[model samples]
Target: MKRFVGFVKKEFYHIFRDRRSLFILFGMPIVQVMLFGFAITNEINNVDIAILDHSKDASTKEIIEKISASKYFSVKDYLDNENEIETAFKKGKIKAVLNFEKDFSKKLQTENQATIQILTDATDPNTANTISNYTGAILQNYQELINKDIVTPYQINTQTQLFYNKELKSVFMFVPGVMTIILMLVSAMMTSISITREKELGTMEILLVSPLKPLQVIIGKVVPYIFLSVINAIIIILLSIFIFKMPIAGNYFLLAAETILFIINALSLGILISTVSASQQTAMMISLMGLMLPVILLSGFIFPITSMPLPLQVISNIIPAKWFIIILKGIMLKGVGLAYLWKETLILIGMTLFFIAISVKKYKTRLE
Candidate 1:
């Protein structure tokens, strides 16, 4: 009994002394809890929406005011004409557009009915459906409030039109996100593990002593993985198109180019990870924990970034996966060319360059 107690006490001392162990036991739990609690949410808050008020009447204005007042949505743009709605959605801020039919108040008074066409960007069908439902509920509640004293209750009929994905298919949303995750994880994980494996097996020293320059060796290590990752990306895209029946409305050449760019970005990140990691286990853990969580949580893959807290929203801008997902959705669902997606593309390019620069610096430091 005394021996066992002393051994346990020594183990406790070891745990307290090791910062990594202490962090794994305490810090990780706190981070995981906070991330799960705050990042994982079904409700949408402050979702940006556009309004095209054809009626521009008293009732229409009041309804718009009510929607604006609600915490769930913010009326970001009051579109001047129907043509501007598409442009707004392509710009990626506007999620839905509330188009009130002409003569809304007059129709409510005389016909005792009005129509509101709720056009939603359904690239993310869950959010689009939620927006439609929430908007409809607001209209329904408004109808009830106005009808309490009247003999005939005025009806507000909502015609929900889901753009990009009229059927509200879940696959449309998941395919892009899944593709982003696969490409990111597979490319990053494989590259990091590959480099780390060379180090672990004591072969990296042999390569370093060879005639090949450090940069050349690093590129040699990465290029095969790049080719393999590209093949994997092609397979995924083809499967998504044929097996899942996902549509590719944009240019295939452009898509291939963007996909290769993202692969390079992810590979550069892997190289950075390999530079700091001493072993395959360390590299694997970093790739999986450090990269996977952020990709899923902060990349706007499963949750809307706008719906996340402001701090998280700002942090998400730094995530390369977020920009790639935006690019993919823009090309696949919105069918927008480089004109509409130039900003995101530039952001990815900048990130890739930054990652490569950092990895090269870190690798040289490690070589020293």
Candidate 2:
């Protein structure tokens, strides 16, 4: 018991000695929270739009003013002709173009209706959709304001249909990605660095010769990180639940089991990395350039896997984070059970076993 406690103490000392690294360890989650919560968003604001007003009248001008006054849009240019609209969009002068019909006020007065065309650059589909929605909403509000005193004989109702996620909350997407990053950072990157640090300091030989068996030594080194990784998962879950109001739709036990499986896979991968790396820096480089970058890019964390090129999509199948994210989204957002997630669960388990076995074989081969 004392020896095990000493092993844990030594590991803790090694970790905490580097104040800078320690700061980054805790800061990672906070930074992820702030980044996803504040910066990465689909919400449109302060978007520059171009207007081609043929009416050039008070009512048309008023509509433009209302759109510009709102926090969502900024009317940067008053286009002269239809030709200018294409030029403005092509030159990146505007995201959207609002074209008012020549007889807007006259048509509104005589026929109680007028037409306007909203053309948006659809290169970035999500942003373009949001811009269109914002424009439509502004126009609808303006229509209601002008027609408030004058009620129409007939009524038009708007029915909105939101699939899967009714609220369309960004948290549903960000939270799962945040969990993946935190796990990858804590379990894979840190573990590899820690093991390699011991190797660099020539302390691994001393531990190997001690009373503890090889497996025991490995466990002693890994236990602390496993605890930390699980704690991180819990913290992320709590933050998602309490702060962001994200739902945990699946069984908690199953979620936890899957998280542990992912952590084990990460830790095993780290161990495999440590076996090949000669120094802490090498391990860190491998973890960052090799492990972390793949997790961020190919894992569908920031981008969709389906949207990737065929070869890249095939490559992504081997990335552990990709499956874990699918599992997370299924359980957390979709409320799927083990039956629905059995394939992902099996993939993670297979990966964990494969990494662990390979790491063990390498460790034994080195010892011999």
| Backbone collisions counted per model | 0, 0
Off by over 4 Å in 1: none
Cα error, candidate 1, residue 207 (Å): 3.7
**For candidate 2, what is the lDDT?**
0.75
Residues 105-165, candidate 2: write the lDDT tens digits: 8878777777788776543345556777887888788887887788662122222323235
- Where model 2 places Cα greater than 4 Å from the true spot, the runs are 1-160, 210-216
Which candidate ranks first by lDDT, i.e. highest? Answer: 1
On a 0 to 1 TM-score scale, where does candidate 1 land against the true structure? 0.96
Window of ten residues with lowest summed lDDT in model 1: 359-368
Candidate 2's error at 220, in angstroms?
A: 3.4
Error of 2 at 103 (Å): 39
Worst 10 residues of 2 by lDDT: 153-162
